[model samples]
Target: MKYKSFAVAIWGVVILLVILVPLPTVLMDILFILNITISLLVLLNAIYAKDALSMSSFPTLLLFTTLYRLALNVAATRLIIGQGDAGKVVESFGEFVGGNNIVVGAIIFLVIMLVQFLVITKGAERVSEVAARFTLDAMPGKQMAVDADLNAGLINEAQAKERRKNIQREADFYGAMDGASKFVKNDAIFGFITVILNIIGGFIMGMMQNSGASWNDILEKYTKLTIGNGLAVQIPALLISVATGIIVTRAASDEELSEEIISQLFTGPKTMFVAAGACFLLTFIIGRFFMIIVAAFLVFLGIRMQDSEQEKIKQDEKEMEERTVEEIRKPENVVTLLHVDPIELEFGYGLIPLADVNQGGDLLDRVVMIRRQLALELGMIVPVIRLRDNIQLNPNQYVIKIKGVEVAEGELLLDHFLAMNPGTAEEEIEGIPTTEPAFGLPALWITESQRDRAEMLGYTVVDPPSVISTHMTEVIKRHAHELLSRQDVQTLLDNVKSSYPAIVEELVPKQLSLGEVQKVLCNLLREGVSIRDMVTILETLADYAPVTRDTDMLTEYVRQALGRAITKTFITPDNSDVITLDPQVEQLILDSVQKTEAGSYIALEPSVSNKIMQNLLKLVEKVAQLGKQPIVLASPVVRLYFKRLTEQTIPGLVVLSYNELDPSVKVRSIGMVTCS
Candidate 1:
């Protein structure tokens, strides 16, 4: 650390000297000696420490030092002389000015340019690190809380954890890559411009001398040049630094750095110096004191910008907090049932637990009672229902078998049924209503075959018509309640409905056509819907005479109905499941795949799937020719196919499923663990 700091300090002093002095032969010799000494020390320290010497600070220091050396040379020759022999020196000076000024100026400009380039490049690296740190810090325990909730069965653990990890890893990788790429490109482009500026400055200086201006006159004229011109060279450097700072800071909030702003900062300095005479006139009266005032104003601007940025950050944080609070407080009309083992239920899938069934029963009872009240007003019959003793899974799907009927099919519907009570808009079913009047109702039907199967399982079926009537009423009431309660929810529903009418009203007989309604309905279906209510609504729409005959009208109506059903089922469940996977998992998988391709069969440490192992082997086969090697498959719950393959002793297929692999393999695996 001490050595590194020393190297940086030496570099800084060199830059300071160059900025304050000019490059004479003596000064150049002195600079060469200084550079050699510092370079040797840096190399020695790097060798001793067994680390790469930081290349980041070198260019900036070198450039500034060159500038100071050049300045000193220019000032000495221009500003000092005796009266009589001064003319002889002046002629010598003119020769030097004509021939050497451009070269010296170019050298100084090149150095400063290089320094700026290095600063941008290295600064980006530092910025990326800061960005990653800030992003990690900004989470404020949210990820941990999400993990805890998942573990506690408040959410789906596997899916949520996977998603969370994915999100974090993606964010980290993108942030680092973006920062690095952007900075490198900007640095290169700016460095090129600096080279051009140096060439221009050299040309201008040579021109002044060729016009017979004395060194003293040139110096006096320089002093008279505008403060803006004096600042022009340094302004690009300052602006670039400020931009780098902003880019680094913005990454904390996950916002992107603007390329336009960076470009403006780089180009602004050169453009400012286009009219040197005008700048000189302004500088003569205002002098350096005015430059000082501008500097002070810039400092003030920096302070104000910092304060504004900080306040904006605070406001955003406050809003996020409020949103989080609102989400937590938002009434959950649905209660999720988890750890469902579809295999146990004898359904093709899995079974939800007995405890979840009991909770479902209680919720069902409340919904039924609400439906009964609503049905009385609608002149519909209310079903008298009793919760059955035995729970059976629907053979066709992992649906809950109540009495003889499948309460819900599909993972999506089952999830909704478990989480939401009937009569809540939050749990509306999705997707089935567009093509058929039965919509999602078929999913809830208790077929005669299903009833007989349920009876064998020690359950009895309730009357179908009564159950359907009661269910429909409950669903409607729930939807109405939700629409009345939530502003955002209501707005979304209204938005979908409003689009068709507005389209018709504005473009009737002109651009508005039946196609517009179809488009609107398609959009709504894609969004999501309540399958249960959608089926009922579609049936009701069929009964309405006006919608029954015209295919276009029916198409639009069906589409909207399907959308409503889909909305109820998909939207509610999605909101509740917000877990994301760690990025390392994907990176690890990708790296492992890459290595295996390079003639090495690699075993992945225990993780999410058997697929990762398969991918590793595939990658190895693609990259190199290897004889059949025992590719160990290490993960929890070894697949039956893998076990069978291992037992057969098949060539190119040796599967060892265990947590502890051999030491040699373990070392190899470390190389496969990727970092972005």
Candidate 2:
């Protein structure tokens, strides 16, 4: 590790020295060979890598290698123009490699340069640009996936962090590669220019000395040396350019390039068999011996591959069966079945695309937003909702489960928009009639073409995903209290204890246990109240717990303390109309109240309970007709029992005591509920 730093430092120093100071031909030859070796190494590394991230520093490597190669080009240029002979490496390349023919040497060098400049370097640069853009565009989705996995317990914190770091590294690598590709392109241009300048300068210098050499001789000597220098430099550049292309275009794979190519290209023998037949037919038109030999070899390889494939398939099946049997034999496997998720969303196969991110579904994102929304709105952390597909249900049907028990279900028409009349559409759009899944409102499933007309007609239009998301949101809200466990409550307390430690310490375990506090919080959530102000709630509980240990009574006091927020949630301060419980009804409920060791309940007779429910239902409808929420105003002593009594008849009936309303809010009685 210590020497590694110095090695790079020395490399940079060498690059500077090579450019600033002239060197001998022998040392230049060694550096040229080393340059070629490094380019070959980079190519091999790119080919063998399982994924791009394995060579994360490749962009920096490209920059460094480009600088070093250009420095070599500079030194070679100087030597050729000054000494008329760059080195033995260049001379050998100029003569033996090019057959000592000026025309042949020039053509060979131009071909290599063109192939590098036009084909490899150009393609690699474009690929790098696209890869960089796509990687950056996909960052948010990848981050959300990591968070989803973390939330679902599929991975722990350390694994999630590592995955996130890899994602960021991948983006940075591709982005850097986008810029580095330009270096490769310009390096090719620089080489071409360097070769031209050397030829021009060498010819001028050769003529100035008046060595009695003819123009042809002077031109020929310098031209051969320039082509040789170009060949030596362009060969390594070509190899590195090819490596850049390979790296940018490479997809994530479990095997090396060679293995992937072999496995993927030859997975089936049918193509090979077809190729053998084609080759055999070519024997008539082409050379009989060569075509026949190729045909026979192909047929033999195809046969062997066919047999190997069958054996591999059988082996895979046998291994799978053995693994299954082994898993079944393990006693702990049954224990896994007993564990249940707190919340789940099971849908039919047809609706799978609605939750699949690959198919443009945003249900998972919507689920995440639902969790966040509830955390803010209800002041409670909702459990992670598991999504899965069930083959047994109708294709478009979905079921919502709480604690492994199905609580609600709905269906969707994926290609249609749900258009509901908000009680103002003058004309109905032509479509299939269906009920809105979230609210059971009468709605039409209209085609995409009809969405505009429906919306123009004042019909509220929603697509399939929104329908499901809204439905899921409402389902979670209705059952938010049920999803809040004791652990969640503890988390809430811990969050509060950070800032307001004294209140939490005073109320929890001192005045009331954790379970009691949880019961009180759940009670508030059940009635659509926010528990965000835990400090206030704790303070109220601390003040009232000594007087009574009953959670139901404690919840009522907390509710009264949060009157301002509750009033803003369901009531208008300027002009609010509500149904008032009759004095006699309050007295009757108070008279029938029964206290037990566990809690309190209203001991009203069945007939009396039925009478009260009938009266309450009438008043609720009366208030609804006035375009106001049906809120029941009752004495604080009777609010809890009244809410419990009416919950079954009117599931979301809002019952608030006079003290639970903000003092500034004006309340007018629209009707009264009585047992008379």
Candidate 3:
């Protein structure tokens, strides 16, 4: 680094010498002062440690002293020079003999030295940037390793130390190769052009000068113009020379020919005046008439290039899209419902009414009506309920087997169902068994109203006695006896313990429906036996449920269900009106609900209404905190209560009847809101 710095300093000194020597006759006094100041600073820093010198005081004093002396010396030099007259020589001799020019000469020397210092500083900065780039490029595989370590979160102190050592070793190894490559790729052409341009320009200028006339003289004679004399001539010449030098340097360094033209145009006004003045202006105007011809040629070239590139890109993209489509369309990628088993039932009632059938209207609306009816009957949200195929019962009575149940009942019946051929229980009556055959017992007795309801909904019912057979009757009796005795429950438990593994294997491969599994569990639970044993059995079975491939869809569905469950369990009536939830949670729910499947609606159970209200209140609070008002538009019942609460306090809350508000107005009225 030090050697490099010294080299830069040497170049800086050389540049200073070049600038100062040519203009010394006019600028020597000032230049001399600059040189002296730099010399003094160097002397001071060398003698005393850099820190010992007070940089602020010493530099300020040196600048002022240098400037004062330079001004005095330049004035003296100008007076002595006396516009290049004989008196100027006389004055200069007088000043030298009298010792009047010593201080001025010293100041001139210092100023030149200061300029050299500035040159050195700028050169050093350029070198530093180049060195940093070289260092970065030389470290082999550093970027890849850094990226890996960062991603894996394994970048500890020891790892970092090892990485640094590795980087340093690689840097040393590759640095030579990198430098050689860069020199071959960039420096060869650049260096060759630079040397060639320098030689050409130098030869041209030298020849022009050696021809008994300077380049400027030739230019003036040819152009029939003189750019004044003395400093005016010198300043323009200096600027032109500097600009030409830069262009030549760039050309020699392999800059484009177009760049050389631009450099020449900008370097001097003379070039522009000669080449692009009135004549060129007239040519430009004429060229506009031929623009259509030029445009046609350019457009054709552009289209050809664009078409080639675009076609290549299109081909690549098409291949990629095809591959992706193939992967997504694979049969294994489809999400199938786990299982679906149909449950058959018998009805003695008449055929269902046409009005009850889901036809000529939206499926959701019909589902809503069905749900409402079920809710009215059950006094709660029925988790699962669906219509099944009709059959005739032995009793000639409307009968239904609750084949598919979602929640567990017990183990004995579950095992029997799994067995696939479960026989019924029987019992003998002591005095009534005298060759008189009995009828099969019905699971449920249908009332006339129930029968009418069933028939209205497109169902057929069987009467009680017509279909009963003696063998079936005996089986029914035996089953009833076993059920009452709880012996069947024990048998089911034993059966489950023995056959659960086999049942699970069969179910898993068959992809049994959730309904079928639920029914088996419900029967076992209802049998009043082996509830714990049945849960264990079903738990084993549940492992066989179809594994979903759409993680995002499954996750979102589970999240929504969990959110609803949380709101129901944690949100209660007491805090429904007062409790508040975080706005973030509410927003999450809102966004999730919006993105839910088109036909699905997130139904908030009545039990969870208060919690949702609390969340809305929280949103209102947040809005208020942000210096905004919350206007709630709700059903009449809600509006009335909210209005009553806010009436006694500040009128910060506004409650509007939902029916009376415009849809757009309603949306703007609240920070957040919930609707049924």
Candidate 4:
């Protein structure tokens, strides 16, 4: 590697030396021949490159080749004008082409210069400029697309990184090529001026040295050498310019230019047969014997191409069948719900504009932020969500699915704004009426024109994407406990095992299994508690798991340990109302609560259960009138049993134990639950 790098460094020094110091004729010929070889290699690489990034270094290499050619031009001018002897290459060209006429040599040089400067170089420069501008302009959208794929779990972290790198490389390559094009344009102008100057200086020198030399002799000797030098430089420069044009204009593709031309252009046999018929007709009129040969070859090639295409298709089908047979033999694929994402957000075709990053929608980015927020607030990692479009639904509808089951669906006018009454609005805002899915709030789907007025009317305004995102957040929160599997518990343990290894070592498997831990965590999350403090919960479990293996019991113990945090969360700072069970009602429940091997259960008569539920509903309504949260403070013995009893019949009742309330919190008794 060092030797190769040193050799490249040495090559660059030689180009500089060629300009500052005079070189031997033999060395000049070698460098001149090497330049032509390098140009051809670059042109061939461009023709065969599968895409522009395959030849990402072409722009830098172009600059070096252009510089080397310019150095050689300067060196050759010095040799011809100073000593009237450039090299054998210049001498042979002069004698062969313009042995008697200088006009022919000059015209040939003019033609090559014009073709390079006016055509190839000019076109390549324009292409490079346009490619650079467009690539840069599309960069933000491309980056957002990669990010969206990452959030949607279509690709993993490593794949997303590779994709992002390719995007950046494409932008960089085009920008570099834009600047590199200037080298070719300048090289063309420099080559023309160098050739003309060398010819004029040589003529002046030859006339001065040989005073009796005729004008024809001086002009003939000088014009031929100048034309030879110009051809040596311009021919390779033209090839480099063609390569640049090819590199800049080439679109990304999976196949090389040769394969693409054959696969796409010649894939159909009809065009080939039509061309063959045309060629056969041409042979009847003009004696183009080659036309008949061409016609025959086209007919043969058409048959061969069709046969090859059929073979490829048959091979592909055979491979697909083999794969299907293999898949059938394996039972995993048949029953593998493991590959299905835990959560998925599918939107309709018209709602697609809300998720597309190119259309200024960042729903995917918002999903990422929501995941991070859930992890912090809920203390469990939400699984990566898969996003897709569904055409079977309404165009403006979106469905939220949990484990492939649609749990929630909502519709949005993507062009309109959602204006929610902050519950304090005195009058209704004029627009389409819609219910906010997340909280079931009364909201209006207002147009852009009504957005400003709605806000002015004391309404909280949100965009369509925010509406969908809000709905997704609430649905996920509602189903969080069901989403917590044994796998998730193991993951949680593994995450914290690194920091508190001893706590995890003693608490899990030794005391409680992962399933027990998952159940306990689910119990806490069922009531919307943040388990971010996993260490404390694990410690509490470690202390109590020996006596009782019941998850509900373990969860109650964990809650008491987290009393201060819990009290701070739901209770207001003003130390307001604390709704407690009446002593007579509490005693009735505590006396009925029965303890057995499989946890505890509270059994009561139908009349007693009915009276207790009626009194509880009245107390709940009284708390609502006072603008305070309804929390039933009771003894620890029946709190767990009461939790299960009220779960089905009473939806919004929060049952808390006396030990779960912090002493720092002050409270006044709002009312009592009784059977009066």
Q: What's the lDDT for residue 261 in model 1?
A: 43
TM-score of 3: 0.20
What are the lDDT scores of the predictions, listed in order? Answer: 0.38, 0.90, 0.36, 0.87
Query: Order the candidates by TM-score, highest first — what do you get?
Result: 2, 4, 1, 3
> Each candidate's root-mean-square deviation in Å?
33.1, 12.7, 29.1, 13.8
> Model 1: residues >4 Å from true position, as ranges?
1-5, 12-236, 244-249, 253-400, 403-676
CA lDDT of 142 in candidate 1? 60
What's the lDDT for residue 444 in model 2? 91
Predicted structure 1: lDDT: 0.38
- Error in Å for residue 515 of model 1: 59
Q: Is candidate 1 or candidate 2 better by lDDT?
A: 2
lDDT of 3: 0.36
Candidate closest to the true structure, highest TM-score: 2
- Model 2, runs deviating above 4 Å: 1-324, 573-575
Q: Which candidate, 2 or 3, would have the higher TM-score against the true structure?
A: 2
lDDT of 2 by residue, 1-676 (tens): 8699798789899999999999999998999889989999999999999989999999999999999999989998899889887888888778865675788778877888899999999999999999999999999999999999999999999999999999999999999999999999999999989988998999998998657999888898888888888877888899999999999999999888999999888767787889889998888888678988888888888999999989999999999999999999999889978989998999999999998889999999999998899889989988988999999989999998999999889898899999999888989789999999888889999999999889999999999989988988888888878888999999999999999999988888888999999999999989889998888999999999999988888898899999999999988854488889889999999999888887788889999889989988888888776656788899998888888888888999889999988888888898888887
User: Any runs in candidate 4 off by more than 4 Å, and if so which?
Assistant: 1-333, 336-340, 625-628
TM-score of 4: 0.54
Q: Ten-residue segment with the worst summed lDDT in candidate 4?
A: 92-101
lDDT (Cα, tens digit) per residue for candidate 4, span 395-416? 9989999988999999999889
Candidate 1 local lDDT, 242-341, one digit each (tens): 3333434332222123444454453432233333334455566777556545555555555665667689899999999999887777676223332232
Error of 4 at 423 (Å): 2.7
Model 3 misplaced stretches (Cα beyond 4 Å): 1-5, 19-289, 321-676
